[model samples]
Target: MSVWDELVGQEPVVQTLQRAVEDAASMTHAWLFTGPPGSGRSNAALSFAAALQCEEGGCGHCRSCTTARAGSHPDITVIRTDGLSIGTDVAREYVRKAALRPALGRRQVLVVEDADRLTDQAANALLKAVEEPSAYTVWMLCAPAMEDVIVTIRSRCRPVLLRTPSAEAIAGLLVERDGVEPELAGAMAAASQGHIGRARGLARDPQARERRRRILALPAGLGTLGDCLAAAQSIHEEAGERSAAIADAADERELDDLKQSWGVEERGRRPTGYAGSLSSLEKDQKRRRTRLTRDAIDGVLLDLLSFCRDVVVAQQAPRAALVNADVAESVRSAAGVWTVESTVARIDAIVEARESLTANAAPLLVLERMMMEFLPR
Candidate 1:
């Protein structure tokens, strides 16, 4: 029920944050929390903010804890970005707000969920506030890594780095916190590869687990060039579907706003310029969709690589559970078919796929090449 309870598999972080809140020895007005996706970087920052602002130092049952966790607290301001980047204009507004006195709590706390997305101007705008924040202001920025934030801003902030927790730790949280069955929680935790969010999703959604099942089954099918192409196509299709699902709601809202601007009702017919503008908008949406799909596929590729790594680890170090424990049989079969050197090469291919996608190479091209490279000699 406490805000700390929601942060699964982060006991060390929780302890540190609690100590800081208890002793009032938290350094620097600004804080940077870095962790991989699903590691709860933003969640930790906000929880720490709540704890700091709470008169009782994060009394789990207090009004401050409840409001802070629900994102309705007066003294805590959280900014989450849906767009590609957070520009300078918004950064300045946050900085100005940080200078103000607390409205309800001991400190005015600001949490930026995607500080890495801050543009150059945005980083600069934030620099001054971080350098000389108000006595009552506490700023927390969350990102994937410390290097992603500007060094100038980073140097001025206290840093919190979260490691990926073990499967046992993640499973324990799911059972104790979410009231999930112990066995099912362990399975999902194993499959999540230390990502608490993905573990929860796989635990809650049978379909997501099924998707992972289908994907893990793919290595057995990559027997020919045609099969590799088919595999690549399936990945592309799935990613497209995932991205379209994300973009559909936002796209509809944008179209509605355009109609309102043109003084037209929802069902009203539009004129020539409207159609042309819509076409351009659709084109932009398509590009964004493609980008998202490619990103999703790249994530899959990374997971696949993790499976291979687990196989290597299992053979070389049998004490550890495979990173792809969900695909243990598949990994065993793969390990049988290939030598350790070949498995390493395949991992290299996965890295190449990631690089290609990030560098804006065509998705199909990168995946196709990766599949070919992964094929047994």
Candidate 2:
């Protein structure tokens, strides 16, 4: 029932954080938490923050625990990014607030999720606060890895690295915590490659399961160059659709909220500054959509690469657990026809796709080129 219990399959991380909480020596003015997506980096930060703030060192049912978990704690402030990057204005605000006194809790804890998304000015703004530590302030920054944060900032913070959880651990968590069926939970956990968020999505959403199944089945259908091209196109189109769906959902909610605030309907809009707000909102939406597309394509590429890796491992190292165990027959066949070198090339293709996306290349164009490279001669 501890707050740390919410972090799935991360026993080592939990133990480390708990020990840090118990002993005052681990308490630092700044901490850097790094892990893969869905690895609970921010969650760990918050739970640890809760433990630090709690009078009894993370008594799970205490008021501090509830407040920290719900993100309404008086002294715990979490900055989350909904846009492409965090600007200096926002960072300055947080820094200014951080400089102030604590309202309720003993230590004023600040958690910044997506520290990698902080713009240069924003990073500098926050760096000042990091450099000058307050006696009663604690800062925890979460990112994909230490490399994502500026070396100056990273150097000032204690590092906490979280490894990807094992599939067996994830499945056990789903069964024990989520009351999921053991068999279905195991499959979802394996397919998700220990990404807790993805495993939960696959467990709860039938559509997500279908999409994963489609991705995993790609190897069996790659008989001809045309098949490869088609598969590539399928991956590209599906990624686009999924990304757009996410953007649309958020965009719609934002628009609805704006309309309500302005008291304007679609057919009747007569506010003084409505048009300007609408323009700004659309611009923000566009950036978010672009980021979402790239993120979705990146995820698709990862899934594709995992399948290839699983196939490679199956052929050369059958004892290893396969990421796509449910589709083992196709993985075996694909590995059977391809050499380790060819499998390595396919993995390279995935790396290229990831590079293109990270470099701001067009998703469709990059995926199309990758597909060409992945096609068999």
lDDT of each: 0.83, 0.85
lDDT of 1 by residue, 1-377 (tens): 66687777688888888888877565567889999887889889988988887778877789888888788999999987655678788899988899889888889999999999899999999999989988888889999999999999999988999888888989998898778889889988987878898888888888988888787777777889999998998898888889889988878888788777767766777765887777866776666676678768976896788777976886678777676776778887877787888888888999988988878898988888888876767
Segments in model 2 whose C-alpha atoms lie over 4 Å from true places: 8-12, 223-229, 252-280
Question: Candidates' TM-scores?
Answer: 0.88, 0.89
Query: What's the CA RMSD of model 1 in angstroms?
Result: 3.4
Give candidate 1's whole-model lDDT. 0.83
Provide the global lDDT of candidate 2 against the true structure. 0.85
